[model samples]
Target: MQETHDINIIAWWGALLSTFLALVKLWELWNDRFRIDIGYNFTGAPDIGNEIFVRNLSSKPIILSYWELLYGSGKWPFRKLEEIESPGPDACDIRIDPHSSKTFTFAEENYFDWGLKTLKGRKIYMRLYVAGRRPVVKKLYG
Candidate 1:
């Protein structure tokens, strides 16, 4: 009887350890998934011509301060680190909450006109920089 009780105890401990390990792995997976997801949409308007709509689809918030738009003309968004590291907010830098979206209205300004002219009949791409995350380089194709 004593030997059977020892076996039962060992089996119980083995199952408990397995369950704890599984829980730890699940927690790690959940933590790994904690990051911002970004998206974009283009809307045409009679006045603005085109609106660049940005969306944050993740469970976390995103700071646009690290964002830089590389025009198809090979224009540099910032020349140096000091320029890129925005200490304060700019027109482009805004905080986006989770599952929220931002719209740049009146995008038909000179910048948009230039963008259209430059991107005409060509592919589009973007360079994204977020703090504590790897740079996301993606090609934008419609």
Candidate 2:
């Protein structure tokens, strides 16, 4: 009788462990369901100039708090950084509905004026902050 009781307790623990792991996996999936996609092009069009595209791939709407441009200096092992945040109250006003995208257009001269050319060919990255979630960062390569 004691042997049977021990076997039952072991089985109960095994089942409990499996259930906990499954719940953990479900939590990860839930967290990853909402995603934001970002892309940019530096080649200026005659009419539109350069553009950055922000897309929402989830089923829920998302509010953007702000964004920043990041560039680095120095070699691989040790590097310094500089950041240029989006200016004005408009930066915090962006919102994207589910399965939609928004394009931000700016002139080439504006890029130069923004001081992005100081590093000359250095790679740039964009960091976006969304309300109630971690920030997303991506390389700005065309």
Best by TM-score: 2
Model 2: how far residue 100 lies from native, Å: 0.8
Clash pairs detected, candidate 2? none
Q: Give the per-residue lDDT of model 2 (tens digit) for 49-78.
A: 667788998888998888876775555678
Q: Tens-digit lDDT track for model 1 on 30-140? A: 875635433455444445444445566666887765554433323358322212112235445578787787654434342333245545544444556655668764444
User: Global lDDT for candidate 1?
Assistant: 0.54
Measured against the true structure, the TM-scores of the candidates, in listed sequence, are 0.53, 0.61
Clashing pairs in 1: none
* TM-score attained by model 2: 0.61
- The candidate maximizing lDDT is 2
Local distance difference test values of all predictions, in order: 0.54, 0.73
The C-alpha RMSD in Å for every predicted model, in order, reads 6.2, 5.2
